[model samples]
Target: MARKPAAAYPFSSSPGSSSARPPQPNTNLNALRIPVTPERRPGAPSPSSATTTSAASSASRNPFLTPSPGTASASPSPAQAGRSTATNRPYGTASAANSSTHLMPPSAASSTASLVSSSGSSLRPQPTSGNTPRAALSAPPLNTSSKSATTAPPSISDKFSLSPDPSLWGGNLSLSDREADDYLHNPDPKRDRKNDRGGTMFTARGIVNLGCLFIMAAGLIALFAGYPIISFFTTTHQSTQGGYNLGGINQTGQVPEITGALGLIDVQTPAASKSHTGWMDQSTYDLVFSDEFNVEGRSFYPGDDPYWEAVNLHYWETNNLEWYDPSAITTTGGNLKIWLNKTENHDLNYMGGMMSTWNKFCFTGGYIEVSVSLPGDPTVWGLWPAIWTMGNLGRAGYGASLDGMWPYTYESCDVGTLANQTQNGGPPDALTTGDPDWNGALSFLPGQRLSACTCAGEDHPGPQDSSGNFVGRAAPEIDILEAQVYQSTRTGAVSQSVQMAPFNAYWQYTNTSNADFQIYNAEITEANGYLGGVYQQAASSVSITNQNCYSGHQSGETGCFAVYGFEYEPGDSGYITWINNGQPAWTVYAPALGPDANTGIAQRPIPTEPMYILANLGISENFGAIDYAELVFPVYLLIDYVRVYQKQGSTNIGCDPADHPTAQYIQNHIDAYSNWNLTTFDDFAAVSGSTWPKNKLIDTC
Candidate 1:
């Protein structure tokens, strides 16, 4: 069916008159302008007078026009087919009917100036409250012979003939003073009546239009200012570690309150940590490991220091497709660069770089700091980069029992016992029942059993009281910062996890289940005294909105660059602290002491095993899953520097600071280690010789 068009409404008060009465001014003039017909007053004059005048004038001026209103009868007439008489009107309104008898001669529709001096009196509209007819206001007769009158069509000024002072409507309108004076000179009743009705209607229409305009403007502002504002406050420039905006989260997943200068590298912390002058950075220290990486030639690459060696062992561990490649290492811009390039070698499709000071240099405890830039954006899948360290006890010729072992193993400590006469030899202890082979058998060093299972029934053991309450323990495998860029696929955010080897019978266990770890991604789990994966207390994790990802596919901005640090000071009861930029994010009392000493006093022993420093860039799927296909090729892990500083006057070992292991080796046999630093080892030969200096029993490792 075809849709019908809506009926049109006549603006004039009467169709019989060619000249419309000027609209009258009223409080409801706006409402009357709407399509709805106004109800007729009870004592209103019949339309016969208007019809007769229009008909008579039409016939005299132009015979082709409709008949005059004077000829229309007040009584009913059967000859008028579709029209109804005044007594039998169908509609309640007098002006509702459309008929030929209701039109006037065209000459009567002239402008206001033409009608002013007419001989006959003209009709005007009455007030709204008046029961009289709307167009009953009588005006002076027009002078037909007036020469000044001209026949021009009426305009808006004639229809809206009322007071133009906008202040009458609460001083918010735009009417001018000149227009108000014109309204006062010409008292138009027709215009006044229409104004009275239309005032309310136009006001309503204006309010609706204004509301729509406001909404559109608000939406436009949000579109333009949204992202820039977010990027400004959340960008990495705000802090070298994590940017914590107002009511927003930091990289450590902490929602900080709005305080201090926003979008600046200022951190608000407790008075104690901020004022504590004993932090490693504040104390005087001697440079132990320093690789400016300013050397680049045929004789050197990135990890080519006399104290460093390239790890060449290849394995398909952690779903990683990359094999360790020595060629991927390079030194440029005064810093070490580990390249993760997509290259096919033999059956391998991807290659990465890894190097460490595993055996060359190891210290008991001190400060380890590194300024490194991660390989790729956190949104880039399969990009895993890390700067960390592992224990040196697993290396060849170490005094510890787990020394000279390829895959480090831990002995089961199902029954906690305290014993001396310890000797450092090979893997596993025979302290528990139902064990297989000599792997768990004791290796005696003539007097004492140096390495034995201490924590009973504990898989991941730490320093504990007699009742198994957690005390403290030194963490092996100190991960300064692990940048598993795509590690948050499961948790849905870019995260940093600080992993440390858990306390096992064999101090630095390499197994994942026995590793003591802390992640900012999610909740912290407590690994109790039950085989090195259980603990007494846990720090609950909370969800945080990750704003570290780029806004577009290739925005050319990674959104984050943080200075990460790990410090171990055994003198402070094995206290370990993780530093984000210069502010301390968290601190843990991780002593390398066991519960077997059975003493609540300070007599409990602390771990003196030396730990080596390492920094590598590799792909791993251990912490979180990865999609290798989604990665961008030719990624890089850029290191500004890796520095190791120790207390100036303190000595964990009796060796002089000038003749320490790393310094001594560099002074005498620097050529041996530095010459083959880039070579990939194809055989399982230990990088050791008899010429290497041997230290005391306590500092042997």
Candidate 2:
């Protein structure tokens, strides 16, 4: 069915005019209708005058309405059809609507009911205030026509152009009457209590935030407290072989037996022993040699043991007053005992025992430790007991064949002689002139003796033949423990030292003035601007003392036992360390010893030759004359055990004869120098044997 168009509003201006407006199709007629008998103010214009007044004059009188800019038209525009006459004010404003009703044509009065009946109550303007007249604002009769029933009501803007005064309405431009009613009826309790104490802190979100903070704090406490708590309950055993208590008491009062985590907290393996000195890992060392002396009544004679042999010679080097007798050394009750006693044998009034592994065993780099109880007779005078080592090329008893290598730590050339001088002032030959090669060059060897070299300018005399000519090279020596009683004052004093011949080139090039090169407990000669100067007799010593350990000379007392240890490594970064009962007493780095100045080669020159161990108890005349009347007789030096350890898959023993030149070759060289035909020492040249073994030397092994 076709729908009819909405009726035009009464006050709409005509088309094609300045005041023309769109039709108000759905505008409420009640809001625009003129009253039958409108009331007027006193002295107001008559109704005829008001009806004939121009829109401009009327707009001037009423602030709520304004006229079009130009002339009024005869008909309304399509857009002005249903629009309210109240253009500047709200539709339901009682005052504005009442004042504007006089502008409506008298003809609009009769048409008001028909327009309202057609538009229906849906298009009527609602009263904004309770004071507004209900009769004036009442809806018309309901429209039963299908067109009016289906049609939507005009928008509130078209029916009632209501705009409240900003000053009176508090600038609430968007709030309608219905919205204000809703605000008044339903209030927000939370907003009303916003300024109250603890309002935000006690909120649901605050509770959740506080809960998160508490959880984080708890986590931090657990993070810090977990370790010690776990450690308290755990048994911190280095090994896992023993039963442990697990916070449970047993009826038998024994520790509970359990396995795995509940029983123990093993921090390290059984083999991984802790290093007392903190320099090296103790677990990496393997026992390469040990003598516990468990066999009772065991003799320490020449043929008694395979690993050790007693020295039966007098120690003439130190001018000792004791003869080292084999009988003075014995294994009694699981201990090797060296007895010091008065004796008339060997033109000496005293006798003691010395044992060594000279030819039988040797090691290049290792840890050597000895558990020993020194002779502690307070009355004993001139008593000196020592545990020491020497290069394998030297024999302990000053054997004629190998005695020449003493005090030479490293292999070196004889520097005192001319580099190119020949043997016997004759042409170079295998018999007359020996090999002069050194460091891959033909040069003067600075330390090695007898190798076609003269001992004229050398600081120390080398081994001599029956004719008093230089014969052999110098060997190195390391003193592990030298317990001496000097003038009856140093009763329990002990010292460790390293002895070597002054390798001139080493001192010549290095900054000998540096603290690293300073010599301790040794004599120094500062002649010729030599800083710490060359050691007068190449020996440096450091005293070792431990107050907790027994160092008194109390014979047969187990309380006198101490563990003396020495660790040696050979190379540029190598070092020799002295340890007293697991604590480092002293250390010497190889590089601090200096290098060869001539060739700038062999910078460290640490002893690389394998060395054999020796321990002796001697009564020396060097300290003082022994007071036999006050000296205690039959005092003993007890040795519990001697142990040598090396790293895994490594050995310090260099006693294999196959690794060196044949003994015959060395003998032939010595024999070549037997017939000294040269009249002057200047005829000799410092030369080394070309065939001399560069590695291990031929030893007694």
Candidate 3:
């Protein structure tokens, strides 16, 4: 491409060009130019002496008016001779005497014309007159010699014009043969490219360097300041509420201090208990009931304590060999004691004590705990001590009418049978009369017939004569801790289980006669029956020796005390968690508790009914054949305390229907049984009236 002439640029200094004045010589460019030293002749003054004198004289003069390099007097001075000699060489090889050559205006045609011709190419001189139009100068022909055979010489516009090319100064410029030879043999340190960068901080490269420095400083500040600002929002705050007061038992008592326990017992406070449970913030719970048994020689009989009653009845349900005598229960040394002694009572060879809060106190859902030392030693066999709870609808001693609440946690229906019963006008005669399968005779109450299909009514001792009579009460059992010797080799283990009979198989066992009990048990032990059946719920067990309990011995062993407890949430979406020695031993969901035996559909039967506590020490008859004479009696089950806590705003109380209202009960029944197995039943909305579904049984307010 043809290059534009110098006068054509907007910055050209030529007269009559209508352009801006030419730019000044860059200080960086001056630093890059190689100052040429003229070779000395025999009779002439040295170039250095002449250059020094001329430069000194020219210091006060206007640099723009300095004479052109070759425009000297006819008899030239020594300085002029040196400047001419330096300018005649290749471009960039100029002496200090001609340093001001670049400051000349373009109208100084002699200086501009000489600068182009000095590169071994001659140029036509431009007119100095303001009105005279200058002709465009063409670039010289490129040198074809072997020295520059491969590369063309830079054009005049590239060398002298104010172009951006770095070669406009001496840096990286192509040198002539003599200059190249001199640079190779006698290099000038001033011509080094590293020293070419000369500019004030306001220049382009200087501004970029400053920007990089600022960026590095900003990154360092961010790195050092980040952590503390993040920690300000994330650190945990200490709770303000103090530890829960356990009836001030820790202050003045002979009771041993509770240790390594969890929930409210471990921390002895609600706020701190949540840190161990990790289930929910327990600070939301309030202490509703507590029994420290601090009084010495206090009776646990019905009239003596408002919260507890000693069991005086013989417990025949499990065919236990021990009769629970109220005389065997007493308080002494700041502890409640239940003594197991060998005696003949109610045709049994042993006597122990069992205490309950059946009609006195109950709760719908909350935290319940008991700390007790079991009786006997680890080697003792047949010793069964348990801490458990049952629904308030059923009394502990009467197993006929009140026993209906023992296992049925949720209401279930035989939809096909109910549909038939509705068409046939009423309940079948087999359900009312003594059909062995539907209503069986109880061993405890021989003449009484209890129907497994119909649960106990809300009215004590009998079913309600109202329309909601068939809507049974929820009375599921939660076994918090039960220690038994299943194997003689392993005796320290304690089991925890949530038991429910949604299919009513437990009723069969309770109502069966002694002659046919084994036959009925065999049927329920099948795959489709009670044992491992679809209705079988989940259970878990852990050895007390493995847990961090007090004394680290078996349940029956002396000096062995463990924390046994459970937390219950009441609703279709609730759960029950069993805590053994302050740790969660097992967890069971509400939906997993009561599944329909026939269809395997989950009933979501978490116990919403109010339940009272029970603590018993009995000798179970189920332990395999062992000589009773080898076991020693007079062992003791010591109770440290029993405590209960309810949610802060809950209004639940013993045997109260406030928490599970009738309207909510109907809605829950509809949600669980509606369209179940593609078979819809009668609407439960009429439960308040006389139109309750014949097939479905639900909880009443």
Candidate 4:
């Protein structure tokens, strides 16, 4: 049901026209132009006032368009049925109805006043508001429908008075800007509360802050122009053992800190023992064991937090632990800082920053046993995880204890020799000075060695001159453990020592003396004296000292620094001040000492044929850390410098430092003995060639 528009609002003349009557355009501007209207002439654009034809069609159903009930004037007596007055009107507005009689019959005013619209002719004007009558008349055939004077009412006194919408002409009655604004912004009264919209502001601030941060960072870079940038990798170069080598197992970027996390070459750490991600880069991983110390010396690993996964080597990535700046160990200037953390991330095999050199780098021939500190708490396992190496490592086939003994036992150590000794050898008291073993033991000459500065009872064997002055010096039975190969010292030298006695012990107990040993992929041998695992069986020197060379009941005594480093000045050896965390205790030693072949100590004692570097942590089952390992390739060992120098030569064929095939290959032949994966005789035998049972001693079989 459509309603006809109200009586056509006579297009009120413009307000400005009040005083200055202007010419009118032929058509009406009653409504916006409907260009789509059919009446639009062919090719001629329609007027802006064009209206819809449907408006006329809808006039029939709507009473309002029916001329308002009885609005017909001068009833045509039913004669003017087909004759009608019609015109377009804007939607919803009334059409201006007036007496056509006035236009044509000026004198018929009275009759027209009382007369209604000609029955079906057109709308009639009455005294709806004003008290005046309009003359009756018929509209001229100018197509009143089309525009003419075009169709504004004969006269409209006031434009605003003609319609309610003054805004249609840009007047105050229209929706003023302020009114529109108020309507849109009125907002709910309830909305009057504290509004903290940190939306766009936050985003903009974030962008600004981000910009500031970048600027600050750039400034910092400029501040430290010469310093290396802390970037991950541009992948600009390849990973070599040198020149950005990244050391295979180490992080490729700046390491802001390292604390609870393992070092680059993480040794037998809880991390390595569990997860198996970096099993391919074991050697470099072992270095991380450098921080295996736990709670004042107890070992810490996944055992403490079974949920520890690979520790992100990047300091910034350390979300678990706190970052600390200590007085030591920094890649930058000033104080060294160590950022450490412990978190839970899937905790898969539970590994990281831990590794080994089962058959990597270069280490073969005579056994090596590492002795490091053990945790004070046995219940807390992983206290003495070791980081010993070996190469060439081929032992007596299966029964030989070490299948890769020759190359396998190259760098080996008894697991926790101090407490786990019976399995590796007899006790310290039962330790036979010299013995040949295949699995992994070292043989040292009888008696210890002491310097001229100390007494005879210190590892010294015979008298000096004729003064009965001194016999031999004291012998270092075994103390703390060894470190993971050589570390990067301050000065970057590579000189270190391994106690040959324990390796001898390892070999003796295993009963396979002929196993080969290698170092840095070269046959294990002295620079000139001992050639490739061969030492003169002939007797050597015997020196002992009261310090670091005592024996028997006194040997298992309080504390001592068994191994001291010296300058690589061809012949000058030095010692470290003995101090237990800071306790005063003179090192125990014997009178004099002797060497089978190896010699460099002040006493020129016997050369340790096949030395073993025991994991210091494993040695005590308590100290739980590598006893002070001093690798003083230090041209001046006295300065505590010197790093293990890797020549970075071209290898014809072997482990690829780039892809790290060595560690992978070793993992294929090795397995850590743990609860989840206990080492079996078969597993150990697979690699224990000739002397299988002898070398692989964790025999649950």
Which segments of model 1 are wrong by more than 4 Å? 1-282, 296-304, 315-319, 395-475, 485-553, 557-561, 591-607, 651-701
How well is each residue in 309-412 modelled by candidate 3, as lDDT tens digits? Answer: 78677776667789999899888776778888899987888999998865456667888877876666544457777888887555555543232335555443
- Candidate 3 has its poorest 10 consecutive residues by lDDT at 441-450
lDDT of 1 by residue, 504-610 (tens): 34322222321223332223212222221111012111222132432212556453444566666653245555555444444444332323221111212223335
How high is the CA lDDT of each candidate model?
Answer: 0.39, 0.49, 0.48, 0.24
lDDT tens readout by residue for model 4, 555-623: 332222122211111001211111111121121111112111221122222221111121211222232
Quality of model 2 by C-alpha lDDT: 0.49
- What TM-score does structure 3 among the candidates reach? 0.45
Query: Which rank order by TM-score, best down to worst?
Result: 3, 2, 1, 4
Query: TM-score per candidate, in order?
Result: 0.38, 0.44, 0.45, 0.27
Residue range 1-701, candidate 2, lDDT tens digits: 12121123233223334344445554544333221212233453333443434333434444533344463422223322222232332333333223333334333332344324344544433212322222223222233444422223344553544322232221223334366368657777876567554356877998999999999999888778976787777956433111111222221243334333112212221233322222444536666556777667777676455556787777775678888889998887667788878888778888999988654566777788888776755434557888999765556655333333455554333332222212333222211222223322222322344332443433222344466443333346787887644443543446666665443333332334333343332221111221112221233444434322332344334454678878877755676777655555656667656554443223334565557789888887664466667667777777777777777666545342333212233233332222222211222222332222221121121
Clashes of 2: 34
